[model samples]
Target: MITLGHAQAIIAGAIAHAQNAALKPLGIVVLDAGGQLLAFARQDGASFGRFAIAQAKAHGALAMGDDTAVLAERAKGNPVFFGSLVGVFDGGLALSPGGVLVRNGDGAIIGAVGASGDTGPNDADAVRAGIAAAGFATGAAA
Candidate 1:
């Protein structure tokens, strides 16, 4: 099992990287296998709303066992189902492209991480960098 400490370190590293790069502040979240929040952080300048968005994105990825990018693509093709999901979650679920699934060495999905407040691609890159910095694999869903 991946500890919350590890998750926090990853998120912190990601945020530090973003800050060093001069990107906008971000809110990041990590969710366990059961879609429970393990750790979260809202950078000093990040928008308050980004906290929820980041969590929702991570939850969606953890729940679906796929990257949010893939889910966004599927949602584009199945608007009705995807639309229903938003309604079901009361607008908390996001099918955006910034969440990624985290898996263990045995190929079991351990959790997921998400970032918000940057562009979708940048958010994804930050999360990827964090995961890699933690000695984890990336593009697991791809």
Candidate 2:
């Protein structure tokens, strides 16, 4: 279970990493395994579009059980199918980057973290750092 404490820690860790790296102001979203929003925040100066993007990125990862980067690749290879998913999901999915799954000791997915405001890789790095700080395992790269 992803508790409030865990969510707060995840956000703090992600923000700390982004600050340390001098990345742009970020918006982060955490979601439970069932795709419910757990915690969310947007740093000062984060863009208006960041919140939704971050949420969608997390939802996309949760829905597909893969990171957004992987989804991007899959979408690129099969635009029709991926596009259909986008439509079916009502635009709640993103296939760029910045999303990662959170797992427990048993390797069961417990949650996800998604971020925006930096480059795709940077966003992903922040999310990974956050999940690590929360003492959760990250599943496969996808």
Best by TM-score: 2
Writing each residue's lDDT as its tens digit, candidate 2 over 9-71 gives 999999999999999999999999999998999999999999999999999999999889889
Worst 10 residues of 1 by lDDT: 133-142
- lDDT value for model 2: 0.91
Q: Whole-model Cα lDDT per candidate? A: 0.82, 0.91
Give one digit per residue, the lDDT tens place, for model 1 in 1-142.
6588879877977887788777788999988888888898888989999988898888888777788888999998999998898788776678887898887776678888899988877888888788777767756633
Scanning candidate 2 in windows of ten residues, the lowest lDDT window is: 133-142
lDDT of candidate model 1 versus the reference: 0.82
Report model 2's TM-score to 2 decimal places.
0.95
Per-model TM values vs. the true structure: 0.91, 0.95
Pull out the clashing pairs in model 1: none
Error of 1 at 34 (Å): 1.1
- Which residue ranges in model 1 land beyond 4 Å of their true spot? none
